[model samples]
Target: MDTNNFEETIKPFFWVAHKSSFSVCLNAGSYKPEIFETREDEGFEGNGYDWGSLARVFLDERKPHLAEYVRFDPEAGMFCAYSSNPESLKEFIVDFKKACEDDAVINDLFSRAELD
Candidate 1:
């Protein structure tokens, strides 16, 4: 598939909050994605999950260069996935979507919310 063309044709946004926050954005590369800490007033309510520690673990497991493009702020309990490579971004979306579908907790969380 021509992921670059596909990516260019769509602007997608995804948000998930559990014990932490995770978001995905397609076509966000041009926006110069950056890491920003979330504030307590932002309504991130969760317990027992250390977002910062999780971010570090995730980053450590990936290639070092990925850290340059992806941003994770544990303090704010958020992770932003962005990359200049459309194919990589597309792959991330596909993999994450499948994971969410397979995970009962994630499926239930999304299904119950009126995200629309």
Candidate 2:
């Protein structure tokens, strides 16, 4: 995942994920992940570049959607998972959080999600 132009590489993956409606960063971190409805917004107070929002540098290519599988870690990279039953956000988020803690469980959830 090493590259000279980080934005060029990461932006496309996120764009595809956004369009496909995949969730991102399903973890137990303090900041929870989100599933966005649109991408009509951009910029940080017009681009101040807040700390720890590294994804923006590349995603700022057009202001990335908030819906992509999301718990981002500058050091560890992105980990993603999904669920078909998004009708209940609270319940699924809880499931995602618990599943994300284990790689196998999250992958299993993603596999099951893909079948639906």
Candidate 3:
């Protein structure tokens, strides 16, 4: 897809949090699709949020860039995904990835998944 199309497709997946406290880029590449959500930690200070660490105890190989908030679920044998907003991560990411695919943006982004 052209650059314009690609941008429009991913618009929903990108957002500025806290006036640019940080920028989050959520992209779903080819694989078993998953979801993520962010939660508010009441005990913490302003915007108290935390996404647990990405576990790598048993991976055949490690992809650090693609392994944020990624964890191994002993029972499932798959990664347990997390999100900046865990509560809305799954649904938001699904739609976000779909939007990119629908616009043929995935082809362009597949190569850049490492940057995500």
Q: What RMSD does each model have against the real structure? A: 12.3, 17.9, 14.3
Residue 99 shift from truth in candidate 1, angstroms: 0.2
**Candidate 1: lDDT over CA atoms?**
0.37
Model 1 segments beyond 4 Å from truth? 2-23, 26-79, 104-116
Best TM-score among the predictions, by candidate number: 1
The list of candidate 3 runs beyond 4 A from truth reads 1-79
* Model 3: per-residue Cα lDDT over 1-116, one tens digit each: 23345445544345334441323343322231221121112221111111111122111122343335333221222223334543243333344356334434333332222201
**How good is model 2 by TM-score?**
0.22
Estimate every model's Cα lDDT from 0 to 1: 0.37, 0.30, 0.30
Per-residue CA lDDT of model 1 for 1-116, tens digit only, reads: 55455433333435333344334542222221211112223432321122333233434443444555555333233335545554444455454434334445333332232211
Residue pairs in candidate 3 whose N, alpha carbon or C atoms collide under 3 angstroms: 36-89, 37-85, 37-86, 37-87, 37-89, 38-85, 38-86, 38-87
Best by lDDT: 1
